[model samples]
Target: MALPTLISAAQLHEILEQNDLVILDSRFYLTDLQKGRQQYELGHIPGALFVDLHHQLAGDETEQTGRHPLPEPSELADTLMNLGIDSQTQVVVYDDMGGAMAARAWWMLVQQGIEVFVLDGGFPTWQRAGYAIEAGCNQATVAEQRLTISYPWLVSEDDVVANLETERFQLLDARAADRFQGENETMDPVAGHIPGAVNRPFMQNLNEHGLMKAPSLLLEEWTSLLQDIEKPIVYYCGSGVTACHNVLAMNYAGLEAKHVYVGSWSQWAKRILRKIDEANA
Candidate 1:
């Protein structure tokens, strides 16, 4: 299936009518913890379920795994069943900031082998387009949660280390240039990125208003970044969350769907020998 990383507002409006479609609102702010829930409480897309960054999207690995760590598959499967998602459902996810946070949930579902898509521009763009909003939460009864757990798409730390020797896949870092360069080390003690990750800030996927830029532009930028490689791409961020945004953008730009480094910087920080910052002074 040709899964477009983004679906237009008008297109989403049409998709909403499908009974088997599941919409997840992933609107979140890194600085403001309460704002995303507040926005969801105030109004959200009709029949959309909310996935909070701190609560549902990740597990309790704040100290070890940056901010968000991959949730246990059984636990995540339960959450999905509660949200009315099954293997057959077409899931749509969105957030306020381009798709940084939303892409986390998108990648999570994809890792679980679920076919999911991201709302290209996210909630703000939906609002800007004058889309109708509705209040109140939606709940569906679940008889039992049955998940066909699939986790083969991800690459392991050993895989990353081995790939570093051969450039098997392009390591894309979806973090700010400052963070990628090890200039700022506040988030994690050890600065610098994985051995050969090229920086591609998640924000580059969006416009000033938090909507995705044109596909042609995205293709051009990613093309420049991947010029030296002839392998599948892999992405990582502070945790595993924001990197999914870059994956979504690359997918939209007609790039291959890449692997996500779920443990990301947090895990890498724990092992200092793995810290290679030659790219930065």
Candidate 2:
């Protein structure tokens, strides 16, 4: 049987002893790049390798790219191979922040057609459940086989602009309502969202306990928002990290969006600003 997209702490505990599984501790802090590794060194799930959000999950950011651009396919494949992930490996990723960062890892693996799961409720739930923790890193024996990258998951900035002009697809922003509305201008230099995008914060996907809502509940929430909209939805967040959380939730609800704007708001805002500068000149 294949593992579901989301797995509970109990389910994870049962499979911890399994050799073919690859567990990733994806804890990250946007403000402090070193925080995730610090936390991992302090304590993490046993037999889990640390996957840095910046170092492994994201590629280099250019003037036109988002803060967390998708890593190069070859780079990511090498990283996965270093982690001993081959075609047969089952990966489970978790973080301290309600699977927000962890979902990025999950989405990347799934895009490559690898079977992966986000630990529901993340590391906190595991700690709460009295599961054992191991300090320092537990590196995997590097695998000789390379994983293939299908590269079909993300939509580019050009695709988003075309969609906006054509109005052929619905645009969903996974940032907070304030950020979506151009109120909080903390992360990105620009304050506003895509011209016609709708706001649905990724955090809403979780319940009071920080665990993902039931699939039925997720379906209800997403269905209400997308009721009158068309298929082939496009989703984005500030830097394309939290947006994956929304994508994961939608997949859990059996609703698949067509594309994820890998550059997201950061790239969009930059392009918009450049246009403004050119017009002013």
Q: Which prediction has the highest TM-score against the true structure?
A: 2
lDDT of 1 by residue, 112-192 (tens): 667788886788778888999998777754525467555565665677768878878878888899989999778787789
Model 2 Cα lDDT, one tens digit per residue, 95-171: 99899999889888887767899999999999999999989878698987998765687889888888867888778
- What TM-score would every model get versus the actual structure? 0.87, 0.97
Model 2 TM-score relative to the real fold: 0.97
- Considering every candidate listed, which one attains the maximal lDDT? 2
**Models, CA RMSD each:** 3.9, 1.6
lDDT of 2: 0.89
Itemize residue pairs with steric clashes in candidate 1: none
Clashes of each: 0, 0
